[model samples]
Target: MIRAITGLLSGIVFGFGLALSGMMNPARVRGFLDLFGQWDPTLAFVMGGAILAMALAWLFQAQTDKPACASQYHLPDTKHIDGRLIGGAALFGIGWGLGGLCPGPGIASLATQFVPALIFVASMLLGMTFFRLWNRG
Candidate 1:
């Protein structure tokens, strides 16, 4: 129960931050991605802030054996670059370039009931479903 509560609270804070940072807007995301044209650097600052916060959190986490709200720290074990990683990253970049919305911001934008966001989120779900099925086969 505590884990779930903390997860929910963290998600709420993250979504609020995304909304406040204008990342929930597809246009703003596309603008950030636009390099040769009118590129917006606001998202870079947001990303920088997030990186700094995560670095600080990691520094704190290094001092602990386990998380306060969990039995153990669940971290990624893979360290090698492989085909699956490259393919997934390529897919993510393509989707982001096409729709200007990644998973986090895409879900956050759902609060607005925007049709494009809805379509993007639905497509993302479908892609995840297909990946799971393919992996299980």
Candidate 2:
């Protein structure tokens, strides 16, 4: 119950932040990616702030034995990057560049009932389903 509540609250905060930062707008995201053109640096500040916050959280986590709501900290174990990781990252970058909406902002944008965001999210889900089926084969 505590975990669920905390997760919900955190997601609410994150979504609110995304909306407030203009990240929920696909045009703003595309503008940020338009380097050498009319590039916007606002997203960079948002990214930097997120990175700083995560770094601080990591530092704090290292000092604790367990999370307040969980018994153990679930961190990624993979240290070495392989071809699959690189390829997936490339795909993600290509998708973001083309659509101007990654998963987080895309989902957040759904609150406005934007058709493009709905289509993007549907395509994302389809891609995930395809990946799952491919991996099982």
Candidate 3:
């Protein structure tokens, strides 16, 4: 119950932050990507703020034995990057540039831009499904 509630609350806060930061707008993200053109630095500021928050979280985590709502920290074990990582990153960048929406903002923008958000989410899910099927060994 605690874990579920924590997840819900965290998601709410994250979604609210995304909406507040103008990240829900595709134009804002695309503008940020336009470095040589009419570039916008708003996304950079938002990303910087997020990174700072995570850094503080990491500092707090280091002082704690375990998570407040969980038994232990579930950290990623993968340290070495391979072809899969590079390919996935390239695909993600392509999708982000073409659609101007990644998973978080794509989902968060559903309330504002229902159709576009739905399309993006559907396509994302489809891609995930394809990847899963392709890697099923």
**lDDT of all predictions:** 0.90, 0.93, 0.94
Q: Count the backbone clashes (under 3 Å) in each candidate.
A: 0, 0, 0
Candidate 2 lDDT (Cα, 0 to 1): 0.93
Estimate, for each residue in 30-58, the C-alpha lDDT of model 2 and write its tens digit: 89988999999989999999999999999
Per-residue alpha-carbon lDDT of candidate 3 for residues 1-137, written as tens digits (9 for 90 to 100): 98899999999999999999999999998999899999999999998998999999999999999999988999989799999899989989988988999999999989889999999999999989998999998
Roughly what TM-score does model 2 have, to 2 decimal places? 0.96
Candidate that beats the other on lDDT, 1 or 3, i.e. the better one: 3
lDDT over C-alpha atoms for residue 6 of model 1: 93
Error in Å for residue 99 of model 1: 0.6
* Highest-lDDT candidate: 3
lDDT rank, highest first? 3, 2, 1
Regions of candidate 1 where Cα sits further than 4 Å from its true position: none
Candidate 1 lDDT (Cα, whole model)? Answer: 0.90
lDDT of 3 at 22: 94
Q: What TM-score does candidate 1 reach?
A: 0.94
